[model samples]
Target: MSQIASTDWYRAGAHGIDIRVRLTPKGGRDALDGIVALADGTSVLAARVRSAPEKGAANAALEKLVAGALGVARATVAVASGHKARLKTVHVDGDARELSGALTALAESIGTRPN
Candidate 1:
């Protein structure tokens, strides 16, 4: 679970943190499974969406999901990149430390205790 908070996935951006997420569209439900490590040592939040990867529904769901997880306004979250790919970068605008704390809590909820 240490990989979830790894610097390799999220970075402090000009306005906020840019988090890498690997979304599974058409998943049975809208949920966050935890962190997943790529073959190349990259880590991403493993998220699932009930919406299909069409007409941007899945992207919207992902934004909402991430916003909820971060305890921020839905409008503050955006799909920064990878709109057409499973792997996406989500841009969240808010207090960086507060957001990080929220993410830490989320990680704990999923049984990934931060060190």
Candidate 2:
């Protein structure tokens, strides 16, 4: 994985970390697109899910995808904010450093950069 400076998409918290995600529902397949910077200069982890954004299906899929990417249990991941919006804040319970490293690796594996 390519090395980069500390990312803004996630922040280490007392319990674990809070990740900023920009989601694309019904995106054909479930995958992490990469890191992206918004117009306001806030970075987010771009993700897509096959599920439609109805009755929280897309939110559930995003939680699962994040848990899998961070090598944590599904129960440990939750959508902390933006229940009905494209951008969301997800909270994961685990070691912050380890999760951050895993996220970095996952991002590199997808070969994506901020756009």
Candidate 3:
């Protein structure tokens, strides 16, 4: 992983950023809680959405939540993998450095407390 808290879960890519997120479905509201370190030594960003994990609704909600928080267009964010799993890889199309910095700040404020 990248070591930089944000880069640990996300990386700069050709299109923009590849983000690893642990999502909480049907959570009361959409929010980014913080980060979490798994027992296997993997770090993932914690986030929650109100939508249930059915028919891709939760995935859609998660993308929207991330896009809104990052000030990017909703169409720019998409779940790249792990559609049926809690851990998902999302691709955000835009400025990787800018997004990485913003996410780093957010991780610092929230810390790795899990959801």
Cα lDDT, model 1, residue 111: 44
Shift of residue 26 alpha carbon in model 3, Å? 1.3
Task: Give all candidates' CA lDDT scores.
Answer: 0.82, 0.87, 0.85
**Lowest lDDT block of 10, candidate 2:** 1-10
Largest lDDT belongs to which candidate?
2
Cα RMSD of all models vs. native, in order, equals 3.1, 2.5, 2.9
Please identify model 1 stretches exceeding 4 Å from their true place.
1-5, 112-115
lDDT of candidate 2 over 1-115, digit per residue (tens): 3333447788988789899999999999999887777788787888999999999999999999988888899999999999999999999998888888887787678654756
TM-score of each: 0.88, 0.90, 0.89
Q: Which candidate do you rate higher for lDDT, 1 or 3?
A: 3
* Superposed Cα RMSD, model 3: 2.9
Judged by TM-score, which candidate is best? 2
Residue pairs with colliding backbones in model 1 are: none
Q: Which stretches of candidate 3 lie over 4 Å from their true place?
A: 1-4
- Model 3: lDDT of residue 40: 74
Clash number for every model?
0, 0, 0
lDDT of 3 by residue, 26-65 (tens): 9999998877777777888889999999999999999998
- Two-way TM-score contest, 1 vs 2, winner: 2
Candidate order, TM-score descending: 2, 3, 1
